[model samples]
Target: MSNSTSETVSFFILGAYLNIGYLRYLYFMITAMLYIVIVVANTSLIVVICVNRSLHEPMYLFLCSLFVNELYGSTGLFPFLLVQILSDIHTVSAPLCFLQIFCLYTYGGVEFSNLAVMSYDRYLAICCPLQYNTRMTSHKALIFIILVWLYCFVKFLIPLSLNIRLTLCGNTINGLYCSNYLVVKLACSDTQVNNIYGVFATALSILVTVLPILFSYMRILRVCFSGSKQTRQKAVSTCTPHLVSLLNFSFGCSFEILQSRFDMSGVPCVLRIILSLYFLIIQPLMNPVMYGLQMSKLRNICKHVLCYKLLAGGRNTVTESCEI
Candidate 1:
């Protein structure tokens, strides 16, 4: 592969987009609606947590971080996707593609790190109820959130840098969006450094994020079993949403990884596309709904806020009607 050949490639052709004919508009509308829902749901929750003084705890702070990340991740993908879906050509400029890759990878890393920290917060609250305030202060939780974002942003840069420098023999990607793995596969140059570093980064990420989650949950479970019924009920009530969210995200990510790395030609194209996008789509949409409804404090506050707004609007309408 000539260096000139790689240098000549200025854009990438996404090969997975199907010829849905007129139904493209339908798909675009559905995708647009989904994006809107995700944005509204996550943003509403973030605002709920931020404005309510009573909700300013370690867990709520973590939830706020999670909601913000959902917005970040969805914004990275949805706008780009809407444009592509409407266009006749399914091509993306090199710079834009790389930017998307950076946004998405960092989003994933931060999400995992946030969830891990949230698990640890839960552990402190449940396992060491007396010392939770001393152990996990709001200031400390803020620091952890800042560190999680910074660490993920910095950690993913290595791969993104390596990826951008690659001499690609091809400019075709077999997916709906820019993927680091697919981009690396197109490289004509030796990718031993990239491959080795990828493995190392992935392992390190799992060790850091997964270990804390496992340890925290194990302690929580131990306490639940040995303690009174009230202890068990408390653990179930608080931990259920977090556990559900973690499992849902894990499954979605697993589907994405499997779709990306393995040959899935036997699978239907529509199903394959859905499975590939499951992590990005489902997690953003699900997190807010799960957390908002499951947590009693959040649910009550949301209801109160919503009812107040509705009543205020009704009062204004009645006043205007009387004046007319």
Candidate 2:
């Protein structure tokens, strides 16, 4: 009975964040379903990569990294969202808010690095066949992933650790979750230093990810188009999805950054949801399906799972027939 009353209060409080009018309840329920699917799909991909030796290449290696990031990333987000959806007076402590911003930036920056690295790997394999193996050696791969994580860690902690320590004036966080910018807006102290440094860090991350990517694709396009027949087809199949993901994330992210100049505070709640989904909803969900598990190797692994299940079923059927 107490649980029921608590749930009712939660629902009421969470409703304040949604203005769906006649369909508010439906919209909230659908969002919940989307979160569940994201968890299942990404987790499935992570498990497959871990248990399957065949997916140990640098590409899948980076993908597995992404899967892990997505896992924790969802944890940092969805639980709060779930609780918010269930109960009202959704408030977070300042330290917790800072932690949320730090995690979000950390994961997001790491993802940028991961995707960029993956893109560069593909570029080398396609454009420079002879040097691909040498270029993307195990040592090199380890160093690269490590550096990406280090870079993101520094970027995330520096801003948040400093900013969150400052006294906060306005305490209300507009978005459902704590975001870096949102927290900065709450600072009782002037946030200009934080904002400047934060923007610098962000620009550095983007440039690090984008410049090499641009060069890689340029060279890749030149090499692929220079050849003909099967090679061209291979290149398109290999790179098209990467291209789609880059466009999706980069476009939204760039727009998001640009909008910050005008104070992202003014942006409507709905638009914020859309932008958040660009990374959380759109990319993570599509990546396992389009990038990771859709590969021929992953497909074969799926076949293996299915075959094992069928064989088990067949044995059960035969045993039952004999008993009969």
Each model's TM-score, in the order given?
A: 0.98, 0.84
What would the TM-score be for candidate 2 when compared with the true structure?
0.84
Q: After superposition, how far is residue 53 of candidate 2 from its true place, in Å?
A: 1.9
Estimate every model's Cα lDDT from 0 to 1.
Answer: 0.93, 0.71
Q: How would you encode candidate 1's per-residue C-alpha lDDT over 247-294 as one tens digit per residue?
A: 988898899899999999999999999998898999999999999999
Candidate 2 displacement at residue 160 in angstroms: 0.9
Per-residue accuracy of model 2 over 5-122 as CA lDDT, tens digit each: 2111111111126643556456668767877887888887778877887777777777778777777676777666666655445666655666666777787888888878988988
What's the distance in Å from true for residue 128, model 1? 0.3
Q: Candidate 1 at residue 91, lDDT?
A: 95
Model 1, TM vs. native: 0.98
lDDT of 2: 0.71
